[model samples]
Target chain A: MTPAVLIEKLQKRYGTVEAVKDVSFQIEPGEIFGLLGPNGAGKTTTLRCLCTLTEPDSGRIEVSGISVTEQPRLARQRLGYVAQEIALDKVLTGRELLQLQAALYHLPRAVISDRIESVLSLLGLQDYADKKTGTYSGGLKKRLDLAAGLLHQPDVLVLDEPTVGLDIESRLAVWDFLRRLREQGTTVLLTSHYLEEVDVLADRVAIIDQGVVIACGKPSELKDRVGGDRITLRIREFAPLEEAEKAKSLLQTIPTVQEVIINSSQGNSLNLVVSPQSDALLTVQKVLQEAGLPTFGIAQSRPSLDDVYLAATGRTLLDAEIAAAGTRDEKAERKKSMR
Target chain B: MSSTMTSTKASLNGKVAVAQTPSSANPVGDFFQETIALTRRLFIQLQRRPSTLIAGIIQPLMWLILFGALFQNAPQGLFGDNVNYGQFLGAGVIVFTAFGGALNAGLPVMFDREFGFLNRLLVAPLSSRYSIVAASAIFITAMSLIQTAAIVAMSAFLGAGLPDALGLGLVALIVLLLVVGVTALSLGLAFSLPGHIELIAVIFVTNLPLLFASTALVPLAFMPIWLQWVATLNPLSYAIEPIRYIYLHDNWSLNSIVMQAPWGQVTLGTALLILLSFAAAVLLSIQPRLRRSLA
Candidate 1:
């Protein structure tokens, strides 16, 4: 079977800036695929191209087997887009907005009402359907947006930063809702800057940076390929830089530990990468104890998605995000997204 | 959550199964459905917030009452044979009100674009993106007609006198043509301009200048030679002159000379044809821009 969504060598540029230099990914049916990237990493640009909102300068994008560039209307029928910004018509009641959405999607009149009812209830928005959307909280508005996107039962649902500013409860609710969508056999593609969100929700992920896809695979597979266990050990609640350096030096001498770095942001905690061993945590504790370093907290686990990003990009996602933020032109970006 | 998911999954499967057969769908039927639905949205907005329409009607009535009184005591026969200032001002207010209201048709669309609501419409499988344009045209035409009715009534009450049925019909046709054309231009600007601020600036700069340059506030002969030439070329002149002729002349025909321009005498039928061409030209010019933005 054809992949639910496919993109190859996608390239787009805005004036002098190369927004998406080279990116390629394919998402199979029934999988939750995540495009993980920092703010200016061209994740939104790629999604815009796929949704046919903006045309790419070069490359192929397909929905199921339909070419998005050649047969956009047909592709649109198969794809549902929930934008990062909640685009609810505040003056319109929830049901009215859904009704407008149903018409825009050309959903058959006979089934439009029934479909709207189901999606509203599915998102637990039945009680709020009659209320004007301006009265809704952020979570409710996002839920209504989701309902609008799913009203036509699209084969692939595309969302951009689905839970970017949502509270923890709302974010978790969105995660659960996405899982339910996958269970119902709708392929989902989402982009996010949050590594933990992608790690917890995406079945497979593509980590993009500076207009390129650096890594793509199942989250667990990517983590495993990074090839080590992470041990974050705090020498004390707020260890001195000298103490952290001393712990790093002592920990680096062990045969099992392959690397040691001081995480200054977290009270100068020592982050260690060790070769796979059953006694990795015990060995680290013994080394710290021998150095007369008090272990305030310590944990060891398989490598996380962040470690995978770090291994590929040489910088943490947060650092990339802050750097990207400094360089982005908000006005230009908004203009690009508008049309 | 698990139980709800299970039940939803079953129903969703059923719904998808029903929607899978796309072969029987009718494109033409779907286009109308979407257009009507979109048009209904504009009407609902107008209904809930009636301020725009209310203000639209009241503003023109104020102009007629205030301007008519301002020029009421001017020398007799200064405007034309046996014509009161209110009589001449009727046609101008009707045309000007429609022009002003139609010029604003893009504001809603611009707001939608800024707010990201236009993306929602763009992402959907629209039968033809022109439905957006069509909906705005329909809404503006309806609104112009209502405002025209109010102005005509107020003008008649102020002693301008009502036109005959055929003349009233002609007045509406002229207003419709003008509104459709202006609305197309505004919507085109909405898509092409960067933001609402820029769009509003254009509207503000264009609104009063166009009104002043037209034959709305003064007769063509009453102006300086340069101003008369400018007014004759104005599309608003074509719209205003014909309606003004039908209101003043008890016995009028297509051959009736309605305007005395420096170039030549413009007949009622010629003025209308000019208005028609103006509407067609604007609508055609915006086609490429609409395709670039909407298609």
Candidate 2:
């Protein structure tokens, strides 16, 4: 059989903004795949195209070998989309909404009740099933949304930023629920800007940036591919530019150091990428001491996904997030999302 | 490499559930199943939050009583031959109330779109998304009928005089056709407009204007030449004239002249045909918008 979801040469444009450009990925059945990107980084756009909410200007999207463009109804049948914003009729009880969902998916009457009960129980929503969703807390609403998405037992469950705006407890519950879903052999695809969320839950992740897939692989493999350990050495708490430059120049002479970047944002701290070794830190400290540079603080660790993002994009994820946030026109985006 | 493992895993899971047919057992059966399911949702909303429905019925009754009292002292025979202004206004109230309620049929859908609830529906394996539109139409039509009954009773109590049973039945047919047409236009607006705010603004702008321009509050002969022209041309007048004719004339027939438009006279049967055509036209006009938005 074909992969659970296959998207090839996906390209979409909104006005002059190329929201998703040349995005392609195959999700193996039963694996949790993550599309990772900061805000405005085309993650949601990709999900929208996959879920058939928006048509791609050019691309092919397939779910279970069915072309979504040509046979959207069939593809939609195979896909369950959980949007970032949980939408539930405030007046209706949770059970009522689920009943509606059962109908929309056309579940057989004989099994609809059993399926609703099972899914509600699976999501721990049995106690709150009779209450109006308007009274539900953020976590309860999300759980209800999850229950709605899974009501049909779709072949692939697609979630867009599922845990955003959720509290820590609710976030953990969502994560646990997703893990249980994966264990049951459902293909899961989710998008998130949170590095750790993707790191922990996703079996494979694609890092999208500027409407392109910059890197994709197992989290550890991507981290390893970036190579080496990162060492952040500060000459002083507020090092002078000259002092930071001197330390950076001194560190450059070390053969173990492959790359050195001065982080001016953090009081001129030196960020060094050094080949993995047991003695790299000691070697750096000794060199700094001989150079009369006092070490205010230093940390060394294996490269993380953030480090991979930094190495590949030349900017940290945090920086990209801030930039993306500033440039995003929320009003315009909300309008675009309406239809 | 992992592909082989996935296939094995999928088959393994498939065995646990024998009837692992991805497609429904029968698509034809599933279509009705889902359509009913979707329609049931709209009804549940009405059951739980009956406020809109309550207000829908009450507002028209209020218009009948308040407008009737306002015009109680009007000169006798001012409305038309052998009918009080209150009775003349009754048909207008019944038609206007249903028309106003139907005009708002799109608000819920607009809210759904803004809240991203529509995205949830679109993502589902719906037989056709038109089921969403159809569900709205069904719900609104039901509400219109209830309001129409309430208005009919209130009008008779106010001594506006009751139409005979057949006359009341004809009034319902007129209300249903008008509601169907207006509801379709409203739903089309809901899909076409960018947000609920815009939809409300359109509803706000269109609501009272349609009422005032039609024969809802005044007789066509009572208006200025231009206003008379507007009243005659208004679709609401097409609906109002037939229902008004049935209320005043016990021995009504299709050939009876129901309305004296500025341009010409419209017979009772011709008025029904016009309302039917209006409903069909509105439904057909919105098809492209629905196709693009729902597609």
Candidate 3:
């Protein structure tokens, strides 16, 4: 069967910045495919290309069997796009906006009213349907946006950071709605920076960094591929660098200890990766105890998605996000997104 | 297009087809459905927020009253044979009001872009992007007619005299041509400008100056030789002159000379053609820009 959405060798550049560089991925039907990355990772650019909001510099993008570059209208017809920003007309009520969206997608007038009602109900937005969108809270606005995107019954719903600024209650509501959509067999392609969000929702995931797909597979598969059981030990609530360093050196001597990282951001917590085995955690504890390292708290678990990212990219996702934040030229990115 | 639409259905047939319809595959039907729906949206916005319409009507009436009064006492025969200053000013006000309103046709779209509302429209499978342009043109033309009707009524009440049935018809035709051209240019600017602030700045700079430079404020005869030439050359003059003729003369015909510039005599028929060409030129000029942005 043709993939619901296929993007191959996708490349998009904004001026001198190569926003999407040689990225490629295919989203199968009936699964939530997550594009996980930091802010400037070219996720938005790739989505823009797929949505036909921007033409790719050179790439193959297809919605169903329709090549986006060749027949954009058809691709658009099958793809429902909920942009990162909730872009509702303030003067228009929720129902009015959905009605307009139905029209733009060319739903038959006879069915438009029903479609609008169904979508609003599905998203729990019926309460706010007649109220001006300007009066909506952030969650209501997002729900309305999602309703508009789904009003056309698009085969593939392409969402760009759907729950970015939503409150916890609203975010869970959105997540539940997405799961229901999958149960109905609609394919979902979403971009998110939240590690837990991707872990929980994505049936398959692609971790992208700097315009490249670093890893792609089931979340469990990717996490296990990094091949280690992890230990995060805080010698104290806020361990000093000296104590954390002393613990790190002692823990490294264990033959099962594959790697050790001192996480300064978490109050100098020692993050250890040991060969997967029943006694790896016990072995590390015994080694640390011999060196007089007091373990205020300790936990052991399989490597997480973040560990996979760290193994592949040499820095933790949070650290990369922080570095990217400092270096990102927001004014420049705004100009790129403007068109 | 057929394969694309069908492929989506085929893959999701197992369970997602719950929403499927018997006639889901018709592209032509869907296209019309969407375009009409999109057009209806603009109408709804206009209905709910009638301020733009209200303001569009009021500004022109104010122009007719205050501006007409400013030149009310001009020498009796100065404008033309048997034509009062108020009569002469009627056409200018009609054209100017339509022009000003048309000049702002892009404002809504510009605001949509800034607020990311255009992205919503862009994401939809619009049968043709031209529908976006068509919707704005339709909205502005409807607005121009309303403003024109008000100006005609107020001018007639101010002793400027009414046009004949045929003359009134000509007035609408002129308004349509002028609005179509100006709306096209405005939509082009809406796409080309970086933000609404920049678009508004362009509108502010271009709006009144174009009105003043044309015959909207005064007739060509009272101006200097160079000014007369400039006014006659202005596209707004082409619209203003013929409508002005109908307001002042019930005996007006296509062959009647409506404006005399330093360059030559411009008949009512010639003026219409000039406005047509101006509309066409403005429409053609923006195609590449619109295609780049909208495509």
Q: Give every prediction's interface RMSD.
A: 2.0, 3.3, 4.3
Ranked by lDDT from best down, the candidates are 1, 2, 3
Tens digits of per-residue lDDT for model 1, B1-295: 1111111233463453355322245668668988998998899889888999999999999999999999989999999989999999999999999999999999999999999988998998888989988998999999999999999999999999998999999999999989988999999899999999999999999999999999999899889999999999999999999999999998989999999999999999998899899899999999999899998
Candidate 2: residue B262 Cα off by (Å): 2.1
Per-candidate total of colliding backbone pairs: 0, 0, 1
Q: lDDT at B126 for candidate 2? A: 76
Question: What overall lDDT, based on C-alpha atoms, would model 2 receive against the true structure?
Answer: 0.86
Give the true-structure RMSD of model 2. 3.9
DockQ of each: 0.50, 0.47, 0.40
- Alpha carbon deviation, residue B163, candidate 2 (Å): 1.4
CAPRI level of candidate 3: acceptable
Candidate 3 to truth, TM: 0.92
Candidate rank order under DockQ: 1, 2, 3
Model 1 chain B lDDT-worst window of ten: B1-10
Evaluate model 1: give its lDDT: 0.90
Off by over 4 Å in 3: A234-247, A264-268, A277-298, B1-32
